[model samples]
Target chain A: MTYFAGIDVGSLSTEAVIIDEDATMLGYSIQETGADPVRAATEALREALSLVGVSREQLHHVVATGYGRINIPFADRKITEISCHAMGAHHLFPDTGTVIDIGGQDSKVIRINAEGRVLDFTMNDKCAAGTGRFLEVMAGTFGVPVQELGELSLKAQKEIPISSVCTVFAESEVISLIAQNRPREQIIRGLHRAVVSRVWGMAQSVGIEGAVTMSGGVAKNRGIVALFEENLGHSIHIHSEPQIIGALGAALLARGEIHQK
Target chain B: MHITRKEYLLEQKEKGRRLMGVFPALYPREILWALDIVPAEIWDPPLEIRQAGAHLQPYICSVVRLGLELILQGKCDFLDGFLFPHTCDSIQNLASVIYDFIGARKPCYFFYHPKIPHGHTARDYYLKNLKALAAELKRQFGPLKMDSLREKVDMGRRISELLGELYDLRAARRLDASNEAFYRTIRKGEYLFPDDYIAELEGFLTQTRSEESRNGATIILSGILPNPPQILTLLDDLDVQVGHDDLLNGSRRLLISNEKPGDPFEYMAECYFHMPPCPTRGSSISDRMRHLLSLINATGAKGVIFNVVKFCEPEWFDVPNLQEELKKRGVPSLVLDTELNQGLSGQMKTRLEAFIEIVRVHRESITTKH
Candidate 1:
């Protein structure tokens, strides 16, 4: 059976996904992209291949994505995370007409068609206000793990509003709220709401169509997803592992290219 | 090609030619050429804003900010005079600041072009303004000789014809030029004397003409000006060609008239009236849409890219409507908010690349159906 590999090296984390000829997912791995993206990509690919019990030579093709995609020398092709996220979301949920990918540094709202081709899209400018980085920095300010902020936010009785659209200014706002002895969970919920509002503005610009799909690390946060669903006025599709969708899309594209050849 | 703008201007000054520092969009270049003056257009000079901030507000566009900064830096000290066209509110305000506040020693000339949807009165107003500018220049320089003005107007018309031909060839994909090389050559006209600029364009046409169409996906660039020229390099690398432009610095300024020159001022006004629609000139949204559609049909462009400058009120006001109209017509477009001289960041690159991919998909779909 033929096999394919997809590696995605982002600003904060790296991911790798392996698939078979039938496009069935074999396994995947996620790692922190510490300092060296190339090393992070290599190790993540190795761990994924080992978990699938496949050798590097046995993989028919390797596609790399994300901002660090250009550093992966061994990959057959480098595609932008924008296209990859759209394809991945469409493959996972065929009804996906719009995709909101809130990644580490940037956020994108992509409008896709039935065949997973991008129709139109909008992204947050060179700012971290509407991205995963915003939440991570807020979590750092609260002296809590970034992964736990979402769970903490779900317990909030009242949601305070985050007025600042900048990450630095928002962090200051969070610290001021903390100084005033505000509830931590409420502040966290406000942060989530702020992110939702920022990304929702982009969604409106693209004019959301059909069903929406949430991808990227931010999609893993239940609080953010719930707020997005509330704003979208509809439920969105989310995979079990939201962070691997970009790599999954890349792997599927690699397999599709092989068949075309 | 070998001489820098400074070197050429210095040489012209030594040769007793007056140089006027002209500001952005829609002006009578033939009038300047007729008066034996070379207009050094001040659009996007690559200089940091050191002293300009003190004189202007933070919200003003960089085109104005940088133009003011160049003056503050004493870069225009050697120029004979300055001309400010009534292009937009920011420029009009800047003109007031320069003439009233900063008090530069040189004489400042103002040209007011009529907004669109005007009748015969507007044309009369434009002609009156043209004569006013000429009479104002005569006080500082010598008398405006009729024969000299007529000859310079003819030279300006030749320059326009050559530029139009080059644009036609590129739209037909029958030109062997990358986006960077093409813009670099065309932008030389901003400072070159009319005779010398005509020679450079004629040389370009003779050398770059191709019987076979070039290979690439064609697109139209609509913007104030193509600054941070790295976009052109990036497009060339991606095998995308800028087939035509609606930029204030490019085709928006071209005179597409083939009629015989009657009166120089009247001819210039006719050319101005016939040029492409622009926001600075108060063109209606429908008129702009019709003009863009005609360009798209003529060039077979798959997409349009509005490379807008950050904080540009005129461009920002029109972009949403233009984009919406294009969308309704089944044409895809991308809007990039950019600042002058700030090269493409990683985020901008990703966005540009993804948009190109979408355009490629659109092209393939059309090809399959045909």
Candidate 2:
């Protein structure tokens, strides 16, 4: 069977997805992005191929996405992460009019039209305070694995206040809290709340619409997701492994490109 | 040698130099240096606009409006070329408007340097941008030899290093230099004679003396485009020594080095990617605040003055977060709403006097406790 491959080379990770003509996922792989994104993408593609037991020669088309998309020399086409994310999120939820993606280093609130095309978007790629890196640093400060932060935050009995919108100052505030005998769970929850507030501010600035879907690595943080829901006063739908959405969209685009040819 | 704008214009006329005007940071000075052209920085025009009108919205930003006013008033008639970067949406569109409507005869180029101060992804993105910019410059200016380019890079780096040293002196409150002189030095270095701007600066530095005792409350200014004479003059008149400024015309223009050899294009890429970025250019607001605080601490600054140009969306987005962060860090900050023609000296003096009094009282109380 003919298959199309999509690769997404993000700041913190790389993802590869394979899909058939019908846009059904055949295989997928996600891995940490090392110093070199090109190598990471190649490795991710290999892993995806191994999972599906399909030879590379079987792939009829290839497309690349994410910040390093243009660096993938072998890709047949390269598309922007903004466009790819909107396409992937829309594919999963037809009514997802907005996509709020908090990645490793940037936060983007994309407003999409009914047809899944980007209408207007606001991106905060210059600050880490509203991104996953902020949570990762906070997690390290609490001496817990980054992945467990979401679960630990759910146990907080009180909402500790973190007024600093900067990641460095907020980290210091967290340390001060630790000194003040504050619980780690409460601090984590406060951290998530701070990120949610910042992201929500951006979403509000660009006019957030109904049926928003959260994508990118930060979407996996249930604590942040919950806080975002509470802050926005609306529920959010999440994809299975939202980080791969960019790659999935690219693969779908690749399939479309092949059909056009 | 110091020259007034009129004198500089006359000198350009005598020398038969094609005068060009550029905005800060992305003027492609190396190319101008090679082409033997006199590039000038458009800081602020003298004309007063009764109304910027509907074509230029109130939310369009003061810097762009000032530039637009300059073009509209025919103040920039002598300019043969104009180079502006995509620093913000207002400025980006301003460049296009000036090129198409006002300065239609002059060649205009807009450098697109996306925000890359947040993550590794951004760093790589900036690197790629540097490569693209180098290719574009080469295309426009024709083939540039490695040796000549290296020499130009070296000259640029040397000038930047001197500017950095001057800033260090200001931070120490050693130079009781007027704001006009400081702004002139930055304008001349970054826009006019970027490669050979050091001789004039060194001459100024030698003649200047440090203040015997620190006067008033020291504050660091943070923003994208600070009009040289207007902002600095206000601070100077208020006896507030601008300890350091992270503006495009200040430290941001001086942060990059050109020591790398072999491929000049590669060196250009390295320099552009590693340079301290302006807020409007996609740098993280948190990182900028942190850097400003560190500079303030080093300079013994009592507070920060965030003078954001009116209607500049990016700086507007950044200022609130920065102010909150500074306050959380125990740093007092004041936000000044700026317009191109607004005479801020009176309001600034009042604010500085009060701020200095507070700093003095706080310091005295700490001493008493000790």
Cα error, residue A108 of model 2, in Å, equals 38
Which tens-of-lDDT digit does each residue in B98-134 have in candidate 1? 9899987899999998886357888898889989998
For candidate 1, the clash count comes to 0
- Where model 2 places Cα greater than 4 Å from the true spot, the runs are A1-261, B13-16, B50-54, B101-103, B118-143, B209-216, B225-234, B258-261, B345-349
Question: What residue pairs clash in candidate 2, if any at all?
Answer: A126-B284, B174-B210
Lowest-sum lDDT 10-residue window in model 2 chain B: B345-354
What is the lDDT for B123 in model 2? 51
Predictions' DockQ, in order: 0.79, 0.01
Q: Write out fnat for all predictions, comma-separated.
A: 0.65, 0.00
